[model samples]
Target: MKTLKRLIILTTLLSLLSISLPASTLKASPPHKNVILLIMDGTNSDILTLSRWYRGTDLQLDEILVGGVRTYSDQSAITDSAAAGSAMATGVKTKADYISMNPDGHPVLTVLEGAKLSGYKTGIVSTSPVQHATPAAFTSHTLSRDEFGDIGEQQVYQGLDVVLGGGAAWLKPQVKDHTKDDDGMLKTKQFSREDGENLVTEIGASGYDLILNRDELLRKGKSSKLWGVFAAEDISYELDRKALKPAEPSLSEMTHAAIARLSQGEKGFFLMVEGSKVDWAAHKNDPVGMISEVLSFDDAVGEVLDFARKDGNTMVVAVTDHGNSGLTLGNQGTNENYKSLPAEKFIEPLKKAKLTVKGATSQLKKDRSNLKEVVSSYGLGNLSSGEYRTMKDAKSMDDLESEMVKLMSKRANLGFTTNGHTGEDVFLYAYGPGRPSGLIENTDIPLVISEYMGFSLKTGKFADWYVNGEKFYRDMGFLVEIEGRTSNNPVMVAKKEDEVLRFPENKNFYWRNDEKVGLKSVNLYDGDTFYVHVEE
Candidate 1:
């Protein structure tokens, strides 16, 4: 009788507590130990917003904003990945297409290097090849982003504790993309270094446990020094990873593996993870592909956060370099009447797609007869009447492929201003120590990390005095040599507009007086010439 009475009393107390408490309550956020910097290449603030609307849920970034970053290159309002990545790596912005170097071609120290300086291990993971701009920015310095061979070589000697991604061809080489031998079957691509040295052999010799596939990566997770190469160029986008032959590791898997390997360091480590294909997908305005990349990146971010939360000393940062395709949310389509973008119309078709437009194009190029079948297999469907005519008249396969991508863009409700980077600011997110509270430049990122780690780093300027490029400046109605004019001696201009168009002073624009060029005070024409006379 006494035991029965006690049990009834305990059950009554539990029921009362459940009824009194609300279903949801806030929890404390995580602390820092190591710093994991995640760069979502070529994504936009608007794209993030659109993603939330489509999914009908908060993207989780809603709760993790550290601040925002203005992403401009040293000499232009728009920045490519190379310059943007360079600015984040070393707090200095270089000329467009340059990686980890000043205009003088000197190497700049990166946050990863700083980590190494303090005996902290370092790792870099990307969807792109390891030698791609973002990863190269942390490990190698080169005058041109196109110098893949040089970039690959320099990365080999960086003493990196963990490096994983695609681009085996850059480190090695290949005879031909689709060369054939005496056999009926296609020849297997071989690794060919110009000097006849194998990078794979050399990397293995340096004490790294080389992993070439997903199974290898997972089975060999405890390696102190690990290297993984999964694709000839970039690994497959997360949306298409299901069909990837030889099975590549997903971004989250790589992140977890990298952390496992690097966490063994006596001092904390620094790691950079790039959702690089996000830019590639955005460049083509493939909403479906871009979102897959974004989701994959988010998965990686979650993995990093989990590690950071457990360690209590890791600083996890998430940011994008800049906007691409000028992505905006709305009913942007071929329809005459504008309606709010129906998320289902875009989602259902893409979900049915077997290949990205890029993949379909490559397939069509290999066999012209397969064009119809390939089109049917993907979301692109049949070509437009004009597109079919243009494809017939096209002189080269490259031109035909370009037209296909455009058609694919139209099929989706997404509209693209340009297939390139834009001069827009991107959002920054953090969940650890020293997270900033307001707007910041791309260069300030490293400075913040350096401060938290008690290290000194060089900081990049706002790059307000740039003239875009020589050709661009000329197109902007300037008739002078690049070196002939300086910011102090600004480029002056006269046009039908009332106000004088100048440079540097309005810095955000190539030509501005007191306001934007199209505004009433500053109208500009194609042939108008600008000059600046700084009279004392």
Candidate 2:
């Protein structure tokens, strides 16, 4: 009996030891200390090979791609800005039209919010509007992609460390008469209209240094928060901007400025830098514009990579949301004579001719005219009348563009796919801790970042209430109630429950009784909580 009692005690102790050892071992190790998400909107992976073949220069972005993970969305052959951006931001595959919302229209928390909650400073920098889909999805939650005004407003509330981009009009008050038609809404009140205060000023009051142009941006400064808006719309593509306005700073300059500000935070920072105009050039089927813009964005990537190298622990991930213009090399065209045309000769004389197509055509008729004189003067030898007529009949920019491509292809390979997006697998490159050793799917991005940031899938509200296949807000301890929409009746208690509740009957209840149920009104709630378990 004494021996049996002693054996039983030993067994009980061993059982407890087994349980405790696993628990101790399961304690997660610290995650990567720093992370940077680099977004290259609509840049295709194939563009890298094409750039080296045609330009004789390998892009810096290509260097990162050599070792990084590359993946595509599950459903679409091609993805839109909203879908791709949302998937990357939230780490889940969603329908194409949704922004930060999940496929079922449920709001999804973003990596930015997760980073912020984890005590890291967060910033968003882009060449496009701050409220544009890519940047907005990472920082704000909205049901529709068209909700720029609301997204812009939400940026202020996010308390982000920095925001740099264009779309000043979205941040400025609308002049009743000057307000343009926005998504079918007539001019009423401007979403951002205020007395003399632009969006920058408002953000500045919240402790951000607002810089308007390149000069101000480059000025050395020490501030935790900075907002720079360079244009009223998406900043111009590199070629167009250089031709149209040479004074603006390049994307690299903006990126450098953003990094300088965000790195100053005590805790590490999360900064998103976007190369936005590549998609626009692709949409216009402008090969020259696409090359110039993509190269310029690559320059910015080089800047970030250099900084991340020095910072050591900072992980930088560069990827495009989708591909545009299905660009591809084609067989050589027959414009052999135009191949030797010097760049200066082709572009300069057009400038000197006061050359609107209309003006040039009218002038060409009066004389075989200074047409040859103008061409030869610019060093482009005399052209036949047939060639002159081809230039004369250029009806749209595309007509003139096609001729230029044929001419330039003789000197360099050119490619195109009508002006539309293609469903091509994009590239993702990452360096630093928590990044997988090899290529990963698009859905894996959020998981990787979350692991690095030390956020368990279980800690997020969405993870438990929705993702875990469990009931929602009720588990968080809030009463579920349905208030009638379009009816002025005061919200009366619709239902009450002790355990987790599901308000399947009222999908729009939270939308109506927002103030009462604490949608945006309060910062904290008291209630029984459900814990979700996720791998770090």
Candidate 3:
């Protein structure tokens, strides 16, 4: 009788607690040891069909199709990468170009940051520069995606286990070479950072093995920390890389390498891999480049899925940030006989091309007199008189490349409505223990991952660790000023009686009256406020 009375009291207390809390707060599940998030940036759902047709087989993504995500920003119907990526990184929607900041302009903890706080290894891989919007949103908190210098520095101090992508140029400030190009004009390669701080040196000092080329990345052995920057900027598109054969590594190669390094940790890991250039190709309405990128991303997906299946304790989730270019398989030309038309008409035209429009344009001379020969040589065949004239009168390199791809797309029956992002739901794919299914909001992605990893983003020590530097000091009666607002380096200075604290913008260590104090996470300046992790 006493045991039955105790059970009744326990049930009554649980019912009362459930009524007091929100459903989201009550949701919980078993945690996975590892999770891999693959994002094909700016890919439309239809591109999967195009990829399937191009390969004559179903994709690794097709097998794990779970649901869809509603892609939109806090204020706009169509979301840019920064906002979309931020929504995925943090479980909140913000303005375009914002990274990990909420609509209220406050820095929020990301899933990766939360994972790090929970003692899990973390990494980010992308075909674009690692400091680009998608990857930056996960690892750093900033007001603008254009602030590559701040983002890059924060990432270095963020203590990520593995970071593999392009953008080595951002780590070092711009330096004039006083050299001339092939046209006898002075060539100036301007880097993005204004601080004059060489981060590559700092990365090495921080106990990371710096890898600059594909061979170095491939030959890398097991290590706790790895930083590989493949190119000066965004890596080449797959088709363009196939033609040019640059020394950069492919997305899958980087993913494979990151997993190899991250798996060495005992606490498990959270890895985000992005096929970053599909959006660029879609913005130009280049179908061939889009197809090539989608295929390349699928190859990376295959690598992730293989690992997840083998490990059994890992979860793999793949999705796109938003739709772009409104790519369709059939255009108005096929309207008359849509059902009767064979796949050969579409597949054959794309097969004839060996290089992307960008690659083909690179072969053009200064005068562009070899446009026809270059176009024909890339397998587009002899251009018509009207097509040649259209490309000949193009205003800029961008225009020339767009026109060339447009002409090729017309022959391939690929239709693109606009060169901008579209407001639409993107397909979601997942595989693992406790994978999310059914329709979900874009912001729910990180929440699902948080649940899968057994962490609480809504209420946790992660948020408490990062305090607003100015507010925290000001409340303690110290005078504070965030210096260098416009420059790449911003320092938070707090002054009190016979004591002062100097927190440099992106470094993990701060100074308290000549003594350096280290933090577990980096100090961040998000254009308006500075965030620093304070130990309890």
lDDT of 2 by residue, 1-536 (tens): 99999999999999888887876476865533667888788766555555454355677876766344333443576777887788888887777767666776665677777787678888888878888989988876566777665567667666788888877767766622222231212345434432233555567777788777878888986677888877766776665555444556688888888888877766677788888877776675545555666777788888988988888778778887878877654333524544564444333322222222211222232323354543332223455677667745655434644544444332343456556777766666776656654556665676678787778543545363323212344454556443332231212232335333222111112222334221221011111211121222
Alpha carbon lDDT of residue 41, candidate 2?
Answer: 81
Clashing pairs in 2: 77-423, 78-423, 173-193
The C-alpha lDDT values of all candidates are 0.71, 0.61, 0.86
Clashing pairs in 3: none
Stretches of candidate 3 off by over 4 Å are: 1-32, 175-188, 463-465
What's each prediction's TM-score?
A: 0.73, 0.69, 0.90
At residue 141, give the lDDT of candidate 2: 59
- Ranked by TM-score from best down, the candidates are 3, 1, 2
Q: Write the per-residue lDDT of candidate 1 for residues 1-536, one digit (tens) a residue.
A: 99999999999999998888776533333323478999999998767765665566777666688678989988999999999999999889778888877765555667787777556888999999888899988877667887676567657756788999998886654532443332213456664555444567768888999888999988855459999998877888876786644498899999999999998876678999999998998877766677778888888988888888788788777899888988654335545644655666545555556766555454553335566665655565566777667655555555654565555555555567877889888888998766665788998888888787767775332112112233454565755333213332234443434545444221123454566432111111111222221211
lDDT tens digits, residue span 163-262, model 3: 9998887888663323333322446766646788888888998889899888999995646799998887888888888667568788889999999988
lDDT of 3: 0.86
